[model samples]
Target: MSTQVKVKNRLSSTVQSLKPSGIRRFFDLAASMEGVISLGVGEPDFVTPWRMREASISSLERGHTAYTSNAGMLPLRVEIQKYLEERFSVSYHPETEILVTVGASEAIDIALRAILDPGDEVLVVEPCYVSYEPVIRLAGGVPVFLKTTMENQFKLTPQELETHITERTKAIIFCYPNNPTGGTMTAEEWKTLLPIIEKHDLMVISDEIYAELTYGRMHDSIAALPGMKDRTILISGFSKAFAMTGWRLGYVCASPDLLAGMLKIHQYTMLCAPTMAQMAALEALRHGRSDMERMIESYRQRRNYVVDGFRHIGLTCHEPDGAFYAFPSVASTGLSSAEFAEKLLMEEKVAVVPGDVFGESGKGHIRCSYATSMEQLKKALERMERLMGRLS
Candidate 1:
């Protein structure tokens, strides 16, 4: 036997059994192919704006490279507090209720780990961001998926929520202006959910990362709802709104007790979010609101163009009120989402994420992100039309 065979298997069964994220497979393929117009990625194509970039560089020049407090830098936390209150009407105490994280990704992991015990159940809406389920399972919790259909514009209804609740349900992972499907819940829709949440006494890990990207109506946080401030962990970052994906700056707002628990986990796993990134995020919160507005307007234009193009080509598209994606049905082509995506990439040189990568309920649809240029969008649409014509 090789010397390596003597190594102990220290890895837990939970880590070994987790399925790899399906969204990554297509992205790997897209990266190697040339001349491909990819609508597969959810990231904005824009570079981080000039001022925020300058802040990062200036922080480096000032030699502010030391690790911050386990929670985050105080100044950045204060800025986040102000931004949340002014923009979303959500108030959080800078010192006690807020924790700056590496990204909303870290916030999700910390929130789940802090709250979930073995066998606890987490409620997640279908066609959500892919990270939610695996993170829950990694925390030794079971994920209960609640399917939201396109007929309802993919928003989870009160009836759906009530039907999925059980004694083991400990928390709900809510993502609006959702991933893979650009579904958004209205204030009225959230009102319907409030009672069920209260009756169940469930903690809500609300992921509002795309909150600023809504087209028509402003985004609202479930944490802002009456009586919810105590039970909800609101997660967001500067990625989508500020074109700051690489910055890895995200923050969470919760009750003082919850923040304390999460901070303990955060301190060990990640001592702090990067000091430079935190400075840049502070600059964004302080001076980048206008930049966010400009980006949102551009996304709105692309959203309309893509949704209309899909309809004109005889595919059914649920009108997306938020986010930079459109989920269009590919069932008429007699192909699974994976098959459609493969064929589109191989033959048409166009790339989109298969909807089923999000969950089982996302089958027969494909997610097209409009985060690329309009010129690229035109090329992708033409390629898709050709693929559809050939399939028919």
Candidate 2:
């Protein structure tokens, strides 16, 4: 046989060196084990409410399965506008400012792709969502991490924001009602950040997916801050609050010019979000308040239960004011967060994500999601206590 030329590598170098998400690695392992009770995933455990499901089914049955506009159905966009104005005190013109996405995941990706230039820096708070750094890298941007520790209740302070700003900095991504840590920024915190953002002329990508899950105080949006709406890309979805993860419905609200750029990318990359999911999401916006209320209440009960349990078992846990996670210090176990999670799963059959998966600053902590049933949480706590007893 004639010798053939060696094939050149076709994959981009940008994708080659990227590490797989640390959150998914642990979940994959847990899924294969029998009798494992997982507190690992950040998704809500509740099923999609019946009303929303019926809306989707009805859409499908009516043969409304054809693709909608690339920006999504106009009615859904209008619904999103109303939802934002009424609930978040933010206003967006549906025709120009809103674009529906497959999920907030896609909204994050498209927003970065639309604005990033090679070597530009995107500031990310440490112990953030697993996807942010990788997405930023994929978009040809550098990820600059700012660490927020437990001493501050995991909230990013204004001084930290000032420290990270620089000539190359293009934007900052804020995930309040944060995943992993469950930390939320107050209105005053947003007020403090506004000057720094305005002074630098940097863009803000606010991921408020957990907006409906806050306790004690209402969730506030950075986009609502003075002089912020013009420079902000606000991303949210129906998943976390409405238990609509599988539905894959989300939207972004930004300036008309920004949305135009994002829409161009979306048109080519995604075509459009699922027609039926958008329809269902419209129903959710209109009528899912009671469902959201019930879910939040249940999560609050679970959060209290888990926080108290962690304290009793000798871990220092921050009482999260929002989101469904309990980020407790595992320093007492004298192990790194990864080691602690591995040991807990192997010895106690309980699964959790190591805090370090979020960043280097998360090394001594572990994130336990309390989105599951109270019964499961109670059992997990017992198993964790037993593991602590053995280690001590």
Best candidate according to TM-score: 2
Q: Could you give candidate 1's per-residue lDDT for residues 211-297 as a string of tens digits?
A: 999988888788888899999999999999999999898999999999999999999999999999999998998898999899999
Candidate 1: which pairs clash?
none
Q: Which stretches of candidate 2 lie over 4 Å from their true place?
A: 1-5
lDDT of each model, Cα atoms only?
0.92, 0.93
Candidate 1 at residue 128, lDDT? 85
TM-score of 1: 0.98
Instruction: State the displacement of the C-alpha of residue 191, model 1, in Å, after optimal TM-score superposition.
Output: 0.9
User: lDDT (0-100) at residue 11 of candidate 2?
Assistant: 83
Q: Each candidate's root-mean-square deviation in Å? A: 1.3, 1.0
- What is the lDDT, from 0 to 100, of the residue 1 in candidate 1? 62
Task: Identify the candidate with maximal lDDT.
Answer: 2
What digit string (tens of lDDT, one per residue) describes model 2 on residues 1-392?
99998887988898987898898878998988899999998889999999999999998899998999999999889989998999889999999999999999999999999999999999998889989998999999999999899999988888988998889999999789998788998878889878888999999999999998998789989898888899999999999999999989899999999999999999999999999899889899899999999999999989999999999999999999999999999998899999999999988899999989989878899999999998899999999999999889
